[model samples]
Target: MSDSQKPASDPRYPDIRHVAEARRLRSQGALIIDALGGIILCPLDTSRADLRILDSATADGHLLTLIRKQLAHPESAELIGTDIADYPPLDLPENITLEKQDILKPWPEKWEAHFDFVHQRTGLAVTGGMERAVETVRRFIELVKPGGWIQLVDGTLIDHKIAEDDKAWVKLFKVLSQCVTLVGLDTSLGVSTAEILKRAGEGLVRNIGEKQGVSPLGKGASSKELEELGYVELKGMHSGFVTMLKGMPEDKRPTALEQVEGLLPEVLREAQAGECEMRWYAAWGQKI
Candidate 1:
């Protein structure tokens, strides 16, 4: 809600290079754009006299793939993507304008209650515990124009059943769970996203719907992509946790990192064998 509450040195916020790779591995390079519900792509009203869409915490604007393919584009559909930095001049379509804003801070007064759709990927936006995440959701609600929709997608929630039969997945997920928990956020955020949004938006958020299914990471098209995403998620977790281990024995830190690095091969092997299936949720609702 205030600038004083902003997170610092967030390793969860990956660089452009990391974002490029991660998005490529997700939703056929649009970062799960395909998973977005019809509320966005199929808006009921055709009167685009003043349509607006907000892509918060958009990294490199890759999620605008659909807009870029618009041959008969909506005359007033404005796709604005915001992030902390432009990061070496992203290549975005004309309809998708790039802006600089950190969602952890208060958004511009002009932006409040003024977007037909507000979309955010949790891995790119909110980090930290429930209180912080709730506030972030509140900000997202603030940006939505009345009768607009807000959709949120969180990373694959850690599932012990998926790891039970695979040692590599077990190891990697263990590290992920520990790191995410340390940051005061639930590992089940992916599965419980609807509740989070409902809690944060209470009176305003309505008609909640959630989509969640197991995506294979082995011997399937989606599985192959999941392999790539898993690698990045694991590496990201390692990077975040290593920083938090500052007071630990210097020798132990590197060793722990090394151990994490070693698990990569197992992730690859298990993924190749189709032993990993990630479950994530895409929860959305209208702001009434």
Candidate 2:
């Protein structure tokens, strides 16, 4: 097929197709929120009845629903969730609206400075590079009113640490990195997000703060509960790696897939030994 006529492929991770993937995304989102200590991390009072909040890349409206429940007056607050594709859950409250929005592009004029708080999780890297990420953050900042806040969350792939050198683990990571890069997903954006936000909102935002944490992978976790959670994340990420591998150019696809398939056993063994861990970053700032 001609390149122009080829079907478009989504570069985003955690393909939301089956019940399992959906559940995984929900669970992952909730865990990150819990680790960060709450749904709304900014200094703003979430209990305020008139607050306006936006959750970008809000698949299935799960986070929005949670935020709605926490509000002092759910009916009075305005909560909107936007994604490039609509997968909204059923029976949503009237005050919560889920609409299809391409966050990488310009939003409607009416949305400018319309929200009291703007949030995005694991979304910006889809822009493919730092420049587009910055552009997207600027738009996010624009969506907030004076003194409103914008927050972001994503993995800092670069900050990951291993207890010992494992050739198989390193090889698999290199292959996965190639796949994400080819798919236009910058997995390292997590650490850079805070700096990007600062650059994106230089004169417009203040009181910027960032937090980081490591989530152990597989059975190497500190506790049974964490071990299970880490396994879930690892599994979901593996699925994404395979999905990206499939999207590679035909000439390069076979070799890369073969390499990843061959390395899985060793990689899993290393993770099970608790030698693998991943890091994430949460950054938030308020508009001046």
Candidate 3:
């Protein structure tokens, strides 16, 4: 269907709850190493006792937990997290406070270069425009004290081949990518982040670490777990795409959801089979 004619009630994108549930499954050993890596970058000192942290699109605060676990004084670092939706129904740590705001706009008047560190994940692709999103990141970096850190964790939806290829999986990827673009977002991180940072005048973009993995059902004990995790991660992607499509004319809604729904079972079956694998990318850099 043409972008202009799509409906407004297409399924909603997955929320923090869904994303958190996926993380929970992964924590339970659902072969989600890639998810884990994307959530928390390694080479982190965790011991840096005093840090001002800002988690953008902090859905359910899963990444917060991961960072807290890795840091030395989880209780001591100051944190401010924001999301476009109402803050997810997750408890904030004593050290962290939640704010509801749009990151694409100017930084809040109350927050003035107060952070020592800033972290954002997943929201880059949801923010509508790459240039605007990168500008937001630039603002985030501006909020941090010089010599502080700015870490970003995100993934692209582009699929890479493993041992086997399924037409269903391929079709699913294409539809989802289209759905994302329809909303003015890009699903591929490898395609944009560095350029975004550079365009924003971010200095010395160093790759702290990188990882890639597949989401399948039974490749190992971890495979089934990954499937459960996919439900969460993909739910967010699905919701975001649907929200964008829903903005279109009403008649085209069903066709879009049908395209999405039709692929879910096959994707689920692959997850269950544990034989297919998809690529997930991750990277982190410091603001010098």
Task: For each candidate in the order shown, give its overall lDDT on alpha carbons.
Answer: 0.60, 0.74, 0.56
- What TM-score does structure 2 among the candidates reach? 0.84
TM-score for all models, in order of appearance? 0.75, 0.84, 0.73
Model 3, range 111-149, lDDT digits (tens) per residue? 666766677666677666677767777787777665556
Report the poorest 10 consecutive residues by lDDT, candidate 1.
30-39
Candidate structures ordered by lDDT, highest first: 2, 1, 3
lDDT of 2 by residue, 87-148 (tens): 52557788888887888778989999999989998887788789889988999999999989
Best model per TM-score: 2
lDDT of 1 at 80: 85
Off by over 4 Å in 3: 1-44, 159-166, 203-224, 231-256, 275-278
lDDT of 2 at 90: 51
State model 1's lDDT: 0.60
lDDT of 1 by residue, 32-131 (tens): 4323432244242435455687877665676655543442355557788887644434565667787878777899999999988788765422455566
Error of 3 at 6 (Å): 21
lDDT of 3 at 280: 46
Query: Clashes in model 2: which pairs?
Result: none
